[model samples]
Target: MADRLQGKVAVVTGAGNGIGEGCARLFAAEGAHVIGIDRAGADECCDLLDEGATGALFQRIGDRHGRIDILVNAAAFAVFDWTETLSYADWKATLSGELDIVFLATRAAWPWLKASGSASIINFASANARHALEGSPALAHCAGKGGVMAMTRQLAMEGAPHNIRANSIAPGFIKTQATARHLAADPAFAAQVLRKNMLQRLGEPDDIGWCAVWLASDEARYVTGADIPVDAGATAW
Candidate 1:
């Protein structure tokens, strides 16, 4: 299990925190040269929403590294509001964050990924992409993640010829800084989530991180155009 990704070059977005950070750490531990990208507090700080900046940054990375063996699009922001109360601006922002960011990052890394001849792209979908979260206003998040899942399949098809594999990880009720805040604000939410979860506990960043490691590793070479749910069976119901 150690050094499963030896000598690989990995770029992980949103690496300053949450699932991204977890994956970055694990990738590095597995002997990949990990580049952590985020708005701040990462190896590379840049606004992923800025198309030009994102392209330029990835170009630099590709040129310097010669190839990108792994690309993890784990950064995104979404607003949770009832559909009736959700503004167009917020809806658009959610799509941009959750859906658009993935596109920009992948597009920027495409050439280098092709160069690798066996690159893997790991995207973050969500349990919300498949099922409702009951009380939470996840309309925008759901749509955005659904787009990611679909886009991943298309990317897999496009990347197949280049030996690049594309896959997604769908998580549920993972405890990150954002979810921690929500759990703090609404203590009952934890109980509600656990009640629906087969594991009866909240997930940690590593819960999703390990799965990404597998997807990024050569062990998953045959796996592509797929979505692996790490939702502790929450989505099973």
Candidate 2:
């Protein structure tokens, strides 16, 4: 969808790497004025987990752009551990990193989104929310993503009247920096994932990026409160 987002103002959090970086670059290529925000390596660096800071950043964006047409909350955090070994602190941290950050950023941008006339919010859920990985410890990951799904739906309902649509994207195992080491080191692990997904391969960041572009563009104006799975059939079976 070339230039599908032309003249749009987009803010992509966690844009320093992985799926966020993919979306920011793709959105810019599609002619959006994209502001890439991350704790590092982006157009803007800020801790989105901090409420005051998140509000201030969005306020500044509103002042500069007058309105925000798109928001991609692609930031997330999780500590992998067996359920029995997962400490309370780790669980809390995961919730703060995954769920709270999205809440804070979206809340800050709500007003500007309403003013955009046609705005879209793309939240990151995970296939983990739908099912557990056979050999992985993802108690916190599942909980956090589940929260994201729930919050996104409510956000969609609230924004519907204002024409500000919200939706979530659940990504499959993509070859991201976070997984590169594991993928290279563990052939058995990689094979297990391949066997489960009907695609028999990993997904790329652009796959999710493309879906986001469609949702952010007028093409998907009717979509909201829906969890779109881009997980290569990880949830289909």
Candidate 3:
């Protein structure tokens, strides 16, 4: 299991904390040279929202690494708001954060990924994308994650001929700063989440990171256009 990605170069967004940080650590542990990207405070600081900056960032990575082997689009801007209360500006911003970043980053990395001779792209979706959680105001969250899946599918199709694979991971209620807010704000939220998850316990950041490791590894060479749910069976029911 060790050195599963030896000598490979991986670009991980949102690597400052949470699941992205987990992936960056795990991937490096498995022997890949990882470039952690966040808006600020990471191995590199580049606003991926800016197409020009994104392209330049990847170009620099490509030049340094010689090729890019993996990409994890784990950065997303999500907010909790009911559909009625979700403002037009917020909705647009949500979509831009969740979907546009993925599009821009992947597009910018295309040449280097192709240069890898074979590449893997892991996009972070969410359990909320396909299932509605009771008492959780995530109307825009659902739309954003859903759009991520759709975009991933198209990326897989486009990348197939180039021996590039694209897939997504929909994670369950993992204990992170974001989820901590929900737990602190509403006790019932934790109860409902745990009740839905068959595991009867919350997931850790490493849970998604480990899944991401496998997806990035050569073992999953055939797993393109797939959406793997890292939920604790929360969506099964």
lDDT, model 3: 0.92
Off by over 4 Å in 2: none
Candidate 2 lDDT at 183 equals 80
- TM-score leader: 1
- Pairs that collide, model 3: none
In model 1, how large is the Cα lDDT of residue 177? Answer: 92
- Span of ten consecutive residues with least summed lDDT in model 2: 178-187
Over 170-225, each residue of candidate 3 has an lDDT whose tens digit, in order, gives 99999987679889988888888988999999999999999999999999998999
Q: TM-score rank, highest first?
A: 1, 3, 2
Tens-digit lDDT track of model 1 for 53-145: 999999999999999999999999999999999999999999999998999999999999999999999999999999998788899999999
lDDT of 2 by residue, 88-194 (tens): 99999999988999999999999999999889999999999999999978899899999999999999999998999999999989888987877887778888888
In model 2, residue pairs whose N, Cα or C atoms come closer than 3 Å (at least 3 residues apart or on different chains), thus clashing, are none
Error of 1 at 223 (Å): 0.1
**Candidate 2 local distance difference test against the native:** 0.93
